[model samples]
Every structure is written in structure tokens, then in C-alpha cells.
Target: MRITELIDRTTLFDRILLVFLLFVTGASIVLIPLYLPHGGQIRIEVNNKLLYKLPINEDKTIPIGGLTVEIKAGKVRVADSDCPGKICVKQGWIDSGAIICLPNRVVITVEGTAAAPKGVDATT
Candidate 1:
């Protein structure tokens, strides 16, 4: 049957149920972020092994396995790396998510609430 015909067959109870579900979904989208935790620490790993856990608020530069990691102003990035392609270095500063240098076997990830920066959804 046509979509309009099916919609016309819906009862008042069905309409009410649909509205309730839409309301619940909208409420969830709005309220959930307010209740969730945000911003914490960053974890650095090498060769699948934990290397360092540092607070995101602190600013420092760390050298591990020929990669230079810099954490400043609540963000962390690979300032420099010996690996080719330099993909990790090009990633720049990030308040959330990770910088993975596969050639160097390094992984840096932001832990806790995975909130992205304002106006940014997900970084490449």
C-alpha cells in the first residue's frame, strides 16, 4: 500500500506513542552530554605497552622511542617523530582522540570523557 494510506490507518494511540518516542529521543540528545564527564588525562603507549599517563591540564614535552610528544593547554600531539610520512606530527593539537604512529609503534590517546573541541566532531 501507499505510505499515506498506512499513515492514515494509524490510531490516536499510535500517534501518541510516536510522539512520546520522538520526545524521548530529543531529550536524550540534549540532556545526556550535560550529565557525562568531560576532560581528564592522556595515555601514551608504545608497542602496545603503557608508557605514560599524564594529566591533560599540564604542559610538557616527552620523548619516547624517537617520538616527541607535547602536551599543552589541555591538548596533546606528536610534535616530532623520526618515522616517515609524519602523519602523526601533521595531526597537530587535539584535546581528545589519539595520535597513532604505526611505523614507530606509538599510540597516544585521551582518556575519560571523549568530548571534542567546540565546532569539531571528529578529527582525521
Candidate 2:
């Protein structure tokens, strides 16, 4: 009827296994983020064409059409844009994923060595 009663009914071996599993889960939560790969480069595309491939380590501001992209401290963001909604500019700095300015036909993506393998569903 109660959690304590259920736990008390568990054998010593079961308790040990539960503790081990908890430890493993905690370790995974802490360690997984550390091992995950970080973006190494920023790719800028215009009109579905590759426009620039810049290193994430270097800080720079790029101007394309009416949009201004700023990269700083290994992060990239759309600092300014002429788009009506300003959604891209509001998205702020990002270390991973992409920023799209639909009106300007611009897309910015962060890429790294751990990119999805060829022939695999990257979205997954």
C-alpha cells in the first residue's frame, strides 16, 4: 500500500541492483553532456547555396543583404535583420542547431565532427 512497504519487501540483491542502477543513471546524466561533441564551424547559406564556412572559435560579424550575423565566444546569432517579424534576431546566440531568416532566404547552421553518418536519418 505504501512505497516504504514495497521497498522493504525487496531482497538485498534487489536493493543492491537498484543502488547500482541509480548510480549509473546519475553518472550518465552528469557525463553524457561532457562527452557530446560541440560545434566546430558555422555554415552560412543563402538561397540554398553555401555562402560561408567559418570557424566557431573566431569571433566575427558578417553582413549579408540586410541581415547581420555575429559570432562570439564559439556562439553564433543574428544580431540584426531587416525581416518583418525579427524572429531570427530574437532567437539569440546558439552553440548548436540552426537559425533561419525566411524572408531573407538565409540559413545558419552549426556543424561539428560528430555530424550524423551518411545515409542515416539525421533528424532522428
> Per-residue lDDT of 1-124 in model 2, one digit per residue for the tens?
9999988899999989989999999998888656644668888999999999999889999999999999999999999999999999999998877899999999998888545577857596
- The global C-alpha lDDT for each of the candidates, from Candidate 1 onward, is 0.86, 0.90
Over the full model, what C-alpha lDDT does candidate 1 score relative to the true structure? Answer: 0.86
Model 2: residues with Cα > 4 Å off, grouped in runs: 1-37, 114-124
State, as a TM-score between 0 and 1, how close model 2 is to the true structure: 0.62
Q: Model 2 scores what on Cα lDDT?
A: 0.90
lDDT of 1 by residue, 13-103 (tens): 9999999999999998788666544458888999999989888888999999889999898888899999989999999998766789999
State how far residue 52 of model 1 sits from its true place (Å): 0.4
lDDT score at residue 123, model 1, on the 0-100 scale:
75
The deviation in Å at residue 97 for candidate 1 is 0.8
TM-scores for all candidates: the values are: 0.60, 0.62
